[model samples]
Target chain A: GQQVMQIPQYQHVQEGEDFTTYCNSSTTLSNIQWYKQRPGGHPVFLIQLVKSGEVKKQKRLTFQFGEAKKNSSLHITATQTTDVGTYFCAGQLAGGTSYGKLTFGQGTILTVHP
Target chain B: DAGITQSPRYKITETGRQVTLMCHQTWSHSYMFWYRQDLGHGLRLIYYSAAADITDKGEVPDGYVVSRSKTENFPLTLESATRSQTSVYFCASSESGTSNYEQYFGPGTRLTVT
Candidate 1:
């Protein structure tokens, strides 16, 4: 069975500060996806990383994939109150049988204070 | 309306009772998934369907059953619920069952078993 581990189970940051969460998979992944869930809300797709060593950005947020395709990281700069939520990283194993199956990390709960 | 939706946003049932959670997507996506989210376990896959009548077990499928009679509906049933089955359930759909597809999640259903 595949597993995705996430770091910083909980984080509290002052507004305008920075935040980062890391993710690692037990097995190589075909691709990785990131999601965010607001308080009492469903998770929403944020971004996806496919190529090794790839980096993608959405506004003040940055996402990176490790060269081995087994790890990833998300960094948020100048964090705002709106960024308070749970962030999750999920990995899809590399195989034909995988078929849209995602092994999700435990998730990092982020809290931003004013 | 247009996106994925789950019925009975909140439910409370007895330990030995049976429960069913409904999931529907208007996008006509080819892939649908069911996941349970606990406090620390994050999101564990319960079952998934590639298309109508094609379903497979995921990481945590025990005590649960799923059926996909049509492309737009995937229902999950608990034959005999237990206290351990109390958690938030999310239904998601994707354009395809391929590695690169991103999932669209429904609002989620919270079930409490006493």
Candidate 2:
């Protein structure tokens, strides 16, 4: 079974500060996806990284995939109160009939103080 | 609903009772998933369906039953609910398994077993 480990189970940052969370998988992944779940809300799709050493950005958020494709990271610049939520990274196993099934990380809970 | 929608946004039940959460998606996606989210565990997949009448277990499928009788509806059931079953449940759908397409999540159903 595939597993994903995310660092910093919890993070508290001041407004305007930077924050980042990393996801590492014990086995190689075909691809990885990032999601954000606001407190008491459903998770929303943020982005997905497929190629090795890939990087994508959306406004102040940046997502990166490791060269080995077993790790990924999400960094947010100038965090704001609206950025508070639990961020999760889900990885997919390469060989399977149902390859797109995700193994999600424990997640990084972010709290921003204004 | 036009997109994806979950019924009984909140529910409370006794420990030994049985309960069901309903999910309906208008996209007619071939892939539907059920996940439970706890405080630190992030979201753990309970079950998934590739299409109607095709279902598979996920990371945390025990005590949970799922059925996809039709393309647009996927329902999750707890035969005999336990206090441990108290958590937020999310339903997601994707077009297929290869494209790394995004998952569209429902509003989530919050259940409490006492």
Model 1, A1-114: lDDT tens digits are: 888999989999999999999999999999999999999999999999999999999999999999999999999999999999999999999876766878899999999999
True contacts kept of each: 0.82, 0.79
User: What is the i-RMS of every prediction?
Assistant: 0.7, 1.2
| Candidate 2 lDDT, A1-114, residue by residue in tens | 778999989999999999999999999988899999898888899999999999999999999999999999999999999999999999987766663688899999999999
Candidate 2, backbone clash total: 0
Per-candidate TM-score against the hidden true structure: 0.98, 0.97
Q: Where does model 2 exceed 4 Å of error? A: none
lDDT of 2 by residue, B11-62 (tens): 9999999999999999889999999999788889999998999999998999
Which digits, one per residue and each the tens of the lDDT, describe model 1 over residues B1-114?
A: 679999989999999899999999999999999999998899999999999999999999999999999999999999999999999999999987455679899999999999
State residue B100's C-alpha deviation in candidate 2, in Å: 2.1
lDDT of 2: 0.92
Residue-level lDDT for A53 in candidate 1? 99
| lDDT scores of the candidates, listed in order | 0.94, 0.92
